[model samples]
Target: MSRVESAVGVAFAAEAPVLIVGAGAAGLCAALAAIEAGAEVVMLERDPVPRGSTALSAGLVPAAGTRFQAALGVADSPGLFAADIQRKAGGEADPATVDAVAAGAGPAVEWLADAYGLPFSVVDDFDYPGHSARRMHGLPSRSGAELVDRLRDAAERAGAALLTQATVTTLFAEPDGTVRGVEAERPDGGVERIGCRALVLACNGYGGAPDLVRRHIPEMEGALYFGHPGNRGDAALWGEALGAERRFMSGYQGHGSVAHPHGILISWAVIMEGGFQVDAKGERFSDETRGYSEQAAMVLKRAGGVAFDVFDERIAAVARQFEDFKQAEAAGAILSADRLEDLAALAKLPAGRLARTCSEVERLKASGGTDAFGRTFSAGQKLVAPFKAVRVTGALFHTQGGLAVDGSARVLRPDGTSLPNLFAAGGAAAGVSGSTAAGYLSGNGLLTAVVLGRLAGLAAARLV
Candidate 1:
């Protein structure tokens, strides 16, 4: 597409008011928020329109304690939400950021629902382990693409210009250390420089960059990329080059999935449904029914850093009852084997070991020693006859590290001093959840993306 570098002259020219890098959910939201705040915004995206990690996501927006809850007679508060997040994260998160998210989350959700026309419904009595209330909201489309489309439309209507296939190569900064704009690579191998008073980077994580992965998350060294192909950490690298401080560089969200023989992204959540994950010797490794983050940590640490999801025909049938399983299958997130021996052969595990594991699971079910989420499984729900197995491995969705920012979304230096005229939001910013698996809450990513994006937009707009 065409790129506009300068609308007029050098200094004091009427260029785009705000330059946003990455057209994913966060970038789009930032652009829209800036435009809504009366700023002329320009969004540059490396990929084509309507495709990114956001499009490939299972969009679940979590909102806890709001006016909608009061109408539904469900009680909740920001304090309760903050307490739950901190408790679940095991005190590893930044209290200030966590508090900010809790306090702003309700209003953010309200904006998404009321202003953005996002359809939402209040779920009842369905609370996460540490949640104080049943305030989790699921999108009607249940795909991040849906939300992105909505935001893109809104931004367009608000006069924000979106340029796709525009890859930002460098971040432009003033001599005073203020970020001025970005330099991007066009589709035809030409470079375009766009300048603005404010710049926002929301280009997502380093899942696609093996070098960054090895440099940061050492435990996931050589891990296969399960994120978007275009997500090569351009934003992070550029930020670092611009002297921005980074945090949690070694942290990432590990997803448990079956590594098909041909290398495809499979969902390990299916295994938690009715299948069993075991080591090469056919021994059950970790609690299969735990939260995804906890399960991912266990799978990565144990089971030789790889495991197999063993299920039977009956169990597979039962697994198909859930929407996640269906989506997993549609997304090629599951592998199949007809018999236990065949699956063992495919997975490179010993057939004898696999047989032993199945027998143990059956025994556990009969004796009521295996619950759904670490409880004993009932005998009636035991798997029968012909078995199946899928070779499983760990993958990542997003990075938990980036530019360290405070409650106001002001980018901070390693010395904990705020950077002037430089702000960060969304996944581009360091997250509140620290290194704890329990603290890796769902919907928090999107929450921060919207909340901090708005905060950063407002903060940047006021600078003008």
Candidate 2:
């Protein structure tokens, strides 16, 4: 299987102590950490532009017991955070992995900000289902592209070699199952060998690969995939060949309010700030108070696999703060109207049903009672005049499954043996979102990416 091209050489790989595959949040965090720990680092990215699932995210990661949380007068603990994950996941996710990630979440996020100088702030006003506190840490621009660009710059400044447009075909290992180096296929039909004391797999999930989805996560087979096409399950494939165990293969995160034609994800914050989702029949099918990922299956099973989200001007004002929502508004994808009839006409929906639904939402808010879907709206946060609406549908974001790894981010075999000199993080490792889409706590993906990436990097550098 080794076809050595003339241009490919092992001299460069010989000098690098750590080799990271994938340039997304996980790989970049690994590179930064490994380099900071006094080791030579090199990163490989399959995409020419290097935008992976991390760039598709909202650039928010949940952290408990951070300085920001403490400053906001919100008392939170890693125990509480892990308990929230357990409750949301119904305890299907591995308890040890959840405990490990939760234990390191605050330190991982704070280290990135305080040490690497990544610009991040705790979203004190934001709230999500399953979390008792406002612990979402977001970038200033609320754009994951900015987050990627910043990490790229930071890694480069720290002297980590980032090689793009190179796809690692397979791992080079000894007969005793000790992984040694990687063989990458270049775009020009060349093979490059990069040797390292340790290899880290950060390539994201398999959302772009329909066959993989059908095999592991069958429920998301027909839905629109909003995640990057770069997530082709390279990690899982490689793991299988290396005799690694897979876990959480059925779990995923789905977005319920993806703007159909515009390709913009209407910010979930809109729903948190008094927005509502309605079907074409103009009736509220489910409670918008549920997590966006949790509502995806219901939205997809609806009559048209589409829904309209309506919000008042005040909620829209908060939504406008997000970059994606602002872009959607500028593109005329977001609709605004003062009258319910006119809004229904614009959306080609039933005006009468829309009116009744709006009234019911307000009544629920005023009465402080549980909705038909078992969702409750708080008092004094009622929707008011001048409504804004967007035509939306459900979409698969990322898979929450892959190779099962230990708490320190070591890939494990079926007998619970760690793969020697190999590590996984981000989408490559099993996530804490249980075994279904509904288990995704807000920001779980990025939180795991940051924490496990750092831990994997630090540990791998130690091995070198």
Top TM-score hit: 2
User: Which lDDT value does model 1 have at 320?
Assistant: 52
Q: List the pairs of residues colliding in candidate 2.
A: none
- In model 1, how large is the Cα lDDT of residue 215? 80
Candidate 1, which ten residues in sequence have the lowest lDDT sum? 1-10
Instruction: Report lDDT per candidate.
Output: 0.68, 0.85
Among residues 3 or more apart in sequence or in different chains, the pairs in candidate 1 whose N, CA or C atoms overlap within 3 Å are 89-439, 258-392, 266-333, 369-376, 370-375, 370-376, 370-377, 371-375, 371-376
Candidate 1 — what's its lDDT? 0.68
User: What TM value does model 1 have?
Assistant: 0.81
Candidate 1 lDDT tens digits, 1-464: 11223223334323566777777777777776777677877888887784577665555555667777888998888888888777766777788888888888788778767877877665442343345677666566455667778778877877888888888776556544676666678779987777777777777777777778778777777655566877677656655655668876665666666354435444433454456788767778777655565566577778766777777666566545334556656765454566777767766788887777787777887777854446445455566556666666766667777887888777777677776666777668877667644466656667677778777776777765
Candidate 2: count of backbone clashes, pairs at least 3 residues apart or interchain: 0
Q: In model 2, what lDDT does residue 127 have?
A: 77
| Candidate 2 residue-wise lDDT at 374 | 81
